[model samples]
Target: MGNKPSFGETDLPCPQPRQFPMLLWLLLLLILPPGRDQSGVTPKAFLLLNPPWSTNFHKDEVTLTCRDSLSPAQGDIYWYYNENLLNKKSEEIQIHKTGYYKCKTQRSSLSDPVHVDFSFDKLILQAPHSVFEGDEVVLRCQAREEAKEKRFYRNEIQIQSNFTLQSVSMNNDKYHCTALVRGFWTWNKEISKHLMIQVQELFSPPMLIASPSSPTEGSPVTLKCETWLPPQRSHIQLQFCFFREDKALGKCWSSSPELKLPTVWSEDAESYWCQAESVTPPIRKRSLRSQLYVQRIPVSDVTLEIQPPEGQLTEGENLLLICSVAKGTGTVTFSWHREGTVRSLGRKTQRSLSAVLQILTVKESDAGRYYCAADNIHGPILSKLIRVTLRIPVSRPVFTLTSPRMQAMVGDVVELHCESQRGSPPILYRFYHENVTLGSSSVPSGRAVFKFSLTADHSGNYSCEADNSLGVQRSDRVILSVTVPVSHPLFTFSPAVPQAVAGDVLELRCEAQRGSPPILYWFYYKNVTLGSREAPFGGGASFNLTLMAEHSGNFSCGADNGLGIQHSEMVILSIIGPPSNKTTLITEGVTAGLLSILGLAVTAALVCHFRTQRNSERLSTTGTPSYSPREFKEPSRTSNTNPQEPLDPVEPQPVYNNVNPGDSDLVYSEIWSTQHTNENSANSPRKHWEDKEPTVIYSDLKKAYPDDSTEQASIVDSDLEDAVENYENVPCVLSALDR
Candidate 1:
């Protein structure tokens, strides 16, 4: 009766052969009993408790109620602690110790075991690893397990549940777990620490910091990302990324805290930031936004431009000096200055890329070398030195013809000097004579001197002009008269028929073509000086004289200016009378063309006579005899006419009154006539003058002498001559008869 059960068998009989060992049976019993009943129907067995997990603090007793689906009402409950049986036949049991516990109902197999933690320091509220925007966060409070009358509170809200299940964290809500005990309420309640569920702003705007603050173009720049997370979760591993205006930059998905640019160009100018994200929790954070800019370099090809691109600068005109930078940005300042001047001619301040320094009214003093400078607060750039010269227009020029004397002589070298009072240097001068250019000369000293040989053609109006780059200016006209020596004089006579009768008038003229004005002309007969004449301006002179029987002699004329006197060729004149034979006297020196001046009335009468002679070649000598009037005595002689005669000035006549042609062969003769003698010498009465003489005066006088070689030529005989001689008693008449 005292036999113990062996390891593999017992005294009792069994149908199965080779039963399992005790340890094996125990494992089989634990694996197969909870899912089935002895009647071969499936039964469900589970534990009912006040909470889900264990706590560390002294907690309320947990009523572990085991239930089976096979049982309708109350059933026997079996309890175990650390795999050892504790009680049976109770529907529920209360436990206070922290250990492995399990239970079974009378109609079910043993249930799974649960572990309890009685350490109060470890009883805490736990939350999800990350809480992001627009996401649900689950929070759990762990305290006493499988206890009745458990209460869950969150931010002072009570949920009607025996145990805290889970919390969905939408904001930063506080959570805790508590329970009531079957014992007294003084000390058996289990409570958990409050848990704060934080709904974090997972990603904030990122802030960026640049190295070398302002970077120039084509230079390197380093940007840093400044982002952080909550202080408590700072240990979380994160990855860094960079962005610019919401676009990813180079190596955007990196873990580095900074981004480096090898060179910053113009295209890199934009707003940039960085982001930091947790590796596991997928939480991302960004820094505040920052702007990045790349600086522009200075222009290299700076230039200076002038307006009016051509011509020189003049006073009272607007001048523009443009100082410009072809490539650059921002404010640029321009300045203009002369080379020798300390002050700048102009200055301009502007924000544009180019600036112009303008001089509204330029002055003559502004002439000098010029240059320009530009600056944009970096450094000054100077343009190449440019020279500007102010041009002054030439003034009225003063012309001087340097004649040794006041008179300009032919074949003399004359100096012409032209100058302007106010003008720029390098002036050109030109001389003009009668509107024809004589010469041109250039001089830098504002005056030009030219030399020219004077001639008769140069004796006219003289003027000069001065010219520079500005304009041309002319001087007043000057009259230039060149003195010339007189040429040979010429003598001529008018009324060129035959020899004139006694008391006939003769016209004589003297002329010279090349000489100065106011020439004096003189008439001469057989080496005796007659009268003289002077031309008022420039030309020749003429004279009138009466002829007598002694007028037959050599004649010439002379002309003189300031030079010596010049004489003309000599000529001979003859005195003629009417004769018995057919005689004719021919005049000479009519073919010589001598231009001479006469009085206005005399010239008009001569023109009328010429016209009449041209119309009628000859006049009728049968009409009543006409005699020409006597001319006033002015001592005059021509190349063929003499002044030593006592003849009236010769005028063109058709015929003499009461005179008939005796057809004389003699060119010269004397007249003798009979007259009444008185006893007393003073008591003679004159004969009638209109009565026709025995013959023409010339014929009667010539016929009074005895004919030596003639008979038909003689109209009167020697006895007639003796009768006339006995009647006249005058010495002068005897003298005429003696000739």
Candidate 2:
């Protein structure tokens, strides 16, 4: 304010003229932030040449460097050729190649203009000429200059870089070159070369094969897998896999070219293929498909059976059998067999769907177990077993008689029978006796009968039997008997010459020597029965009858044994009457007379015989003396009164010499006595002849009385002697009658 004196007038402080505001303004300005320059820190600039490098000149080195405006310092550098990466050091890189190139620094700065001029005699990329699809190949970049390091790159990627004397590898392509020093410049000459690679095909995979080119249906088959490779590559290790359609069969790794599977069935057959792969890299495939065919085997069911249903079979009957098959195809073989035997009855083959067998006519041996089998290629198959059996029946029989006495006499008969029980049909029966077969007959059902007439020879035991297919049976024994009858009888009589007198009896007898039983007999004379009697045992019968005129003629007898009557032979009998009455008187009076007469006659006869004998003796001895005078007297009777009569009387009577002297004497005495009586009578009376013989009569009277009496007595004695003789002859007469 001191200076403030001037304050009012303008130059006085020219105001310190706005010094008044300058203070404020200068202070404000000092407190405000500093202002910055608009342009950045000195910008780093670089240049990249196109197609950066070439190796056209011999022993040429390509260098590429990056220059920066900043101080020279070490930094990471990158190089590129086209879009590929390159190796670098210190913001620089070295290369020997023909390629596009570029570079950068690690300081976040751009390099100076990049130069790609590097001359090489040639550019080369190391890669395989041929490789599999997935094989690995490498490309390397190198320089001809011996002292220069080499870099490797591919497709803009950085690879390692070797020292000047080392080699490097580059698997991918892209590159650039650079110098190790900073800011080293190269001309902008660039050249590019491309690497070439090729890929080749792998070995085709293996093929699969099957055996039995074509197989029958249902038959077994085999399959095989095989592969082929180049002769040089055949030893290469490879893995093989086999497939059928989508299915994997199996895997095999071996030097051999083939694989095999045995006995494949139908289901295993299909299209088949194979593959081969190297152990290291790419896998390769090849395949072959083949159509497969499978064939079918024949099949069948066989059976055996019997006919006529069920039942036991008979021997000699017909039998039937059959064999058959149900299902089969193609040719089938059939055979028949018996169980437990290795042999077959028969065999046959047929293409037909069905088969059969038949058998007929059976025997006992035909029965057995039977079976059948069928086959094609498959096998022989067996059927169920069947069984058979057999049977038989019986025959006929015969009968005979054995008992009740073999021989029968009169009325008798025999009985016989035959039978057959067990036979099929028509049985014959026969009967026999005494080894003679009688007759035969047929019996359809059972039995037969026979009757025989009895005979004497039928006497023996007989047997019968029957037979058929079954056997024979015999019958018991049988027998027979017979009978006979009686015949006529005979009779005879004895003394049949004349009549049988009184006191005599005639005998008549009847006999039957041959007859059967109790015989009744009767004796008859002239049809009258003397007596009725029975000779029970059949001997002769006798009848006695006093001789009578009425009982005398035709005597006979009859015999009967109750069977029939038999008459005996006829006989004749004669009867005579006793001596007449007159004869009786002459012979003898009743009783005493007859006796006396007989005695007297005997005495007289004796006296006469003695006198005769005496006389004869006296004549010889006493000479004529003492003869009875009556004996010497001779004829006293008349005799016609003549000399001749005397002479006739006088004639000596001749004596019978055969007569005894006693007999002669008796005779002479009788005659002399009669003569004396006659002489006396003749003299006394010459009256009647009857009277004239008075003396004779007187002599005759004596002679007559005595002679008559004697005669009677002799006759009586004779009769008695005859009766005794008759009595003795009676037995003889009876015996003759019996004969």
Candidate 3:
């Protein structure tokens, strides 16, 4: 054994088997350091780990240290593993791999090596190569062996522990792992594994929708179903289904999501929805519900009909019309129209109905085209036109006379009649004169007649009016004339003596007090008329003619005016001869003169007597005479010729006187002769005695003395003279004597 066999530098398996020899060798080696103390002086360095040992994988770490004395002199230090340099460091070295490691300081003189075993060290995984946003990448730090706990480290920072394997999200970074053994230093190692994670964006389903906003009822509608998707998905085929009330409509598949129907009716009203589908994994069913409203369109079948049909209507008749609907519903309003004017008849709102319009007592004004209309709340609908006609009956009318022929005279009668043919019933007839209503009689079947007596007052226009309900119609005007009867006539002669003289014109006029037009007058003078004339609308008629001896006769006049003839009172015309110019002589011997004288005296006396009688009668009848004579004077001289004898009362006297005288000489001639002769003698010779004394006469011996008879004559004469004197002086003179 002395020999441990010199084990220096020997490669023997049992070299250390014998300790004595090994110790002797190490002692020798130690003693022998004369060669350069190659065994590094006990290194003044300490090994340092960044993180403490833990069981977690991400918390493990290891550090190799080679601290040299002298404040780590500036010299390259070589880190060695098993006496081989693995890395060089000035101060320390880090180890990321899970393995046993030792650090040595190599200089001109070698340093003691610091040995570390990282058997429980963790290996850390680095960040991935590439990673996208929102991606999960695993970063693992695994320990070489299970440790009580593992800790991970990044750039000397400690991580969570308590795990055999630690993981972290990747962020493109290099990573390392470290682990700790219960009774040893921490061990850690970096891994070369890198991860590259790529992140992708998620896709969402497309949105589908319908269009057309809001739709109305009964209107044509279009539905649109559309979706918005990424442009990259445009090529994908898509199908859409439009549905209403959970029912599919028509063909559901279409390139576009819109459905179009030309028109919609009330029956098509419902809630609507749509769906869009694609070949993609998840089908898109996007829908919206919309309400569809249906509206009713009013029908237009309104008619108007008149109840009685339009025809001629009389006054006080009723008018009726009806408004009906053939096809309509809802509130129906009925209105009647006349002449384009509307009238409210009646209305029914609950249901469709009819309306009746009645107009009582129809008149002429009610005739017109009548129509009705039916209306719902929607609009007014007109009906067919109906014509209405009204008829008016004739009414009872009055009649009047329109002519001026009402009043008529005797022998003249006027006819007046009135007609009212339009009246309902036949009318009776009556006549009126000066407002006097006449007896009523049947009007016959035609014209009525009335007769009026002709009279002066009848000279007026007559009028007649026809009576009917329609109206009173007057006839043409008429005039009437009445003829009057002639009145009694009177006639008288101008010269009232005996008759009218010859060559005298006798006028005869005939007249009547009253008559009508066209009066004819005829005049007669001495039974003959000079001319006949007519007096129209009469006054009087006259005739003038030259009277002749033959014309003396009874004359009369005739008057006629168509009514009757009238005659005037007759008048007689007379003609007489004038007296002769011979004179008569009256004497006591009955001479012509004497007889004439005596006759004149007697005639004068008789005429006086008769005249006195006539005067007395006139005075008695008329009460008094018009004239009377005053007292008369007697003869002054005593008459010598036995005074003129009184004239015989019976004999008539001549109107003329004659005288004869003879010349005498103192012959005692009668004093009357003497006075006469003296008077004649006193006158001139050219003046005749006849002119001087026309009635004076001298009897032959005029102075014969009177005997006693003369005395008696004287006495008689005296008495006669006294009587004449008394008679002449009397105050009571005869009326004839006065005249």
Better of 1 and 3 by lDDT: 1
Q: How do the predictions measure up, each by TM-score?
A: 0.32, 0.23, 0.29
lDDT of each: 0.61, 0.49, 0.48
lDDT by residue (555-650, candidate 2, tens digit) is 788888666778877866667667788668766656776676566455444444554555576688978845221122223345555554433333
Candidate 1 per-residue C-alpha lDDT over 647-690 given as tens digits, one digit per residue, 9 for 90 to 100: 43332221111122357533222233333332243442223323
- Candidate 3, 602-701: lDDT as tens digits: 5445544544565576689989853222112222333335347542222111111112233532121111221112233447322553465433433232
Which is better, 1 or 2, measured by lDDT? 1
RMSD of 1: 28.8
Whole-model lDDT, candidate 3?
A: 0.48
Q: Supply every candidate's count of residue pairs whose N, Cα or C atoms clash at under 3 angstroms.
A: 31, 55, 62
Candidate 1 has a TM-score of 0.32
> Which candidate, 2 or 3, would have the higher lDDT against the true structure?
2
